[model samples]
Target: MNTTIIEHLACLEINNLILQPPFHLISNIQWNDKGLSFDGDIELYSSDIRKTDFIGRVPVQIKGTTTHKKQHKKSKIKHSVNKKDLEVYYKDGNGVLYFVVTINPNTHDRQAYYRSLAPLDLKGLLDKLEANGNDSITIPFKKLDNGHLERVCKTFIQVVEKQPKQYIEASNKMEFTDYTFNYADIQEDLFDPFEEPVYIYGVLENIEIPIETATLFEIRKKDNEVITIDHEEINVEYELKETKEVVSLIIENSLTCEFNKKKKTGKINLSSIRTLGSYLKCLKLIKYQLEHNKLPFKPFEVGAKINNKKDFKNVYDDIKMYEELIEICNKIGLRDNYVFNEGENLSSLFNGIIDIFKHKKYQLLNIGDNRKLENTMLYNLKLSDFITIKVMFVDNEFIDFFGEEILSKIGGLVPKKPINKTTAEWDPNNWEEIYFKASIYSNESIKELQKATNFSFENLKLSYTDQYHDIGIDMTINIALDFVNYFDESLDSRFMELALDLIQRYLRKFPDNDLGKINLYIIRFKQFNKLSEEEQEDILEILERAENENHKNICFACEVLLQNKLKARKLFSSLDIISQTTIKDFPIYRLYQNLG
Candidate 1:
């Protein structure tokens, strides 16, 4: 009649249920002595006994008691679970299987009952507890049987996988805290006009706040006062806002922290944190403080383009999609952060995304409000007179083009390909890309940015999606300079890469052209202010080589990027006597036009 014996008996029953035949052998149960949030995990495999066949795992917890007609309900076993456990599980936003086994005191005859506490159901229960005083919950677990075993296991496994969880094992051992233990949640949703809602998830979450020195931020100085520092820079004084304690931090170009969009990656410098374990503890503390709205800033900021108030929904969708993209890096089980290298074999995750674009079709609406068309200079003159940006989303997954109902609703395609999967070249010369992903920002997104954060909001003008953008740019020296000066920020990375490729082709034919190398350096490493410190070092380092080889023109071009107007003007003045050009054609002329 011991409670411990009854508990073990219940555990044994679950074990026996898995081991016995006829029920099928695709599932296995793992039990532990004590559970924090779960007693054990139940894993489902496609095959009978291979690790590679793992579908997913369902976290399970069980309780047992001997009852002599102890106020029992029909087909139910009542049990009390820890309030803390319920809180932990509720925060996770994942499903848990609660099992209760009741044993008759005299005969030790037992019957098992189960209740799958789904995330929404947990939310409801937790909401009730939050409304009232915090207390433990007594769940009335329902009937469970051998016939229902596989169904239950698979269902909870789906629940676990579908839940938005940003999980990554630290590169080093870390302390287990709220961040490590808690389940991450999808914050909210937004809709767009041209596109239906796309569910975006964050791959990185609860990242600890890193202190940055004041010198990390710099102001563009007077032209005459431009100071150039090499790769390793000077020490800056850092004052902790909370403690007001000033400390010295040595600034290295390589140590600059920011997302590398060019490479689609990011990294956290772990030198300051002694070990990953301490970072975890700090993350827990930060999350706790942040929830209380005590923190001044988040670890990082996200910018979006939403034109109108309703367009804010479009921004939210993109945010979710970006989060999902970052999740791919986590799912790939590769590095701790995002890295998309040229020629690296794309994973199934990338395939899923490329599948969305390379295949997913939209029925071009011909009617009033639904009929959306915009002017695009790339296709304005040649390809089509009208272009409607259509984003197709359905059923939480990118639907395949097979048996699609899009045939009769017919519209024209750019350089037409089959309706199903298109193998269209991503060539810039022909403007063959019909579908590709773009990052957008808008004022409406800025408003929501205010609503979502406790930190300060800055009104940033995201470069407008240029309808005037066209390919096959003129390669003459002045025209190339116009290309870099005018379109530096708005220039698409694809277009930039193509321009660099074109420059390379030009260099091959006329191998000794300084203008060719200058154009290559200008456009290839365009937008000096935009590049991260490390990227800036790359440009400066290349310029140093040009200096060694006595490449005067190339060395001076680096000054144009560095905004050393005094030096750049001295070199440029020799060529242009008339000076008949707008700042857009040559922004280095800002030096000649403006005086301090």
Candidate 2:
């Protein structure tokens, strides 16, 4: 193998391609030998020895190992392609017309093969390309013969046409427009999925922050991002508004390409498909543009604004309007958010949503993802003792207003929210300690807690003691009581009052289980001074009539609250060990600590 002879053969192959039929047909096509910029002109197109003519100007690269295997009409030529050469090919305005031509040394019969080396095709595979230094690509070139050259030219046009007249230079405030076949005109029966999907192309200008997108349709993850459930399809006409011609040159079909310019990126969506129309996917947008007097898609020659909620419904790019909205939302510091219940009044839910988004800056409206977002928000939510949920709603307009509502129009309800929050109570005997009452409930306690928060009695759950299992109702009730206490944290008197107030309400429903109210006393004894005489008497009366060990412990706790140490010790001593010790644990344990 002589180096000079190998170079001669390479030169000979290049000459044959340039001198051949399809290659010879393309005018602006040539091969040079001496260096122009990159061994040949504009650096890559510099110097090749042979040249040719085709449908349009195209560059060519060939790969092979002198082996061919037929699979139907095409055979594979496994040869390494240079990465540098590939980049140069993509950089060219016209796509590369690459081929793998192998000539048998004995017969001198030439077999040419090719693989698509379009800009988009290379862009997608650039990351996956092997790292073999200069020769990183060992392409599997398909056999390219006379019969399929027209199809190749058609595909080449499809790739080149959608490319923005300009590749955006700056990352910010940039915009452009592109043309592609409208999917709305697609006839499913006529579509061939094997054909490469043409992208909806457009140029972007002056974007505050640039987004990576392939087409206008990609701006939305789904149709709902930019539209409501009520709207079946959003039709944005790509009009030749400049001409406004009445003579509609009847083309293949009433085909139109849509462009949806969102704040970050824009997209096109399909509305309806017709069995009657020619499949839009097959239409060559670039060819149409070349043949017609005007481009089907163009820049925003008109100005518009999306300053309000109504503006979002319309699909148009408004630069100043978008910048203004972005400024306001960013200034307000919106963050990643999940919104209000779907069942809630629309206005209230929207208010809740606006507070958080305008940021995460992801979706302008989160319509379809309501359930998934709800679940995630619930999973991550943490609430303190006060989250008053409605027991009954005459209408959905009602808010659980006992507490100054924080998370929602009213404290957002659970069933709708997680019930993992376990209520705790102070140890009755040892004022400094508190225990979780929720731990006593069975695994099904979550459903019961949801019932408590929602005040829905369906399939209520109960708790089990090692000795006796009937504490679930009590635990569930206390859990509800814990969350619904809306008293001011700083006011010990208010804390104790809320404790008593909640217990009395539950007592009305579970009168037989009055002993269950013992947990409520995490109600502060130190606040003994804060209570009026009537309030003190009411608490004392409740304790004095104690019927069991747990109840007597509360009675002893009350004696201590009144500073009657002698009576408190005596009351405690008279009880059995179980009765003397703490029975109920409350969430507001600090409210019930010992006076000492």
Best by lDDT: 1
lDDT of 1 by residue, 452-476 (tens): 2111211111121122111122223
lDDT of each: 0.43, 0.38
Model 2 agreement with the true structure over 312-331: per-residue lDDT tens digits: 24223332333344343222
Question: Could you tell me every candidate's TM-score relative to the true structure?
Answer: 0.28, 0.28
Residue 340 in model 2: shift from native, Å?
38
Model 1 segments more than 4 A misplaced:
1-110, 114-130, 134-486, 527-564, 570-577, 580-584, 587-596
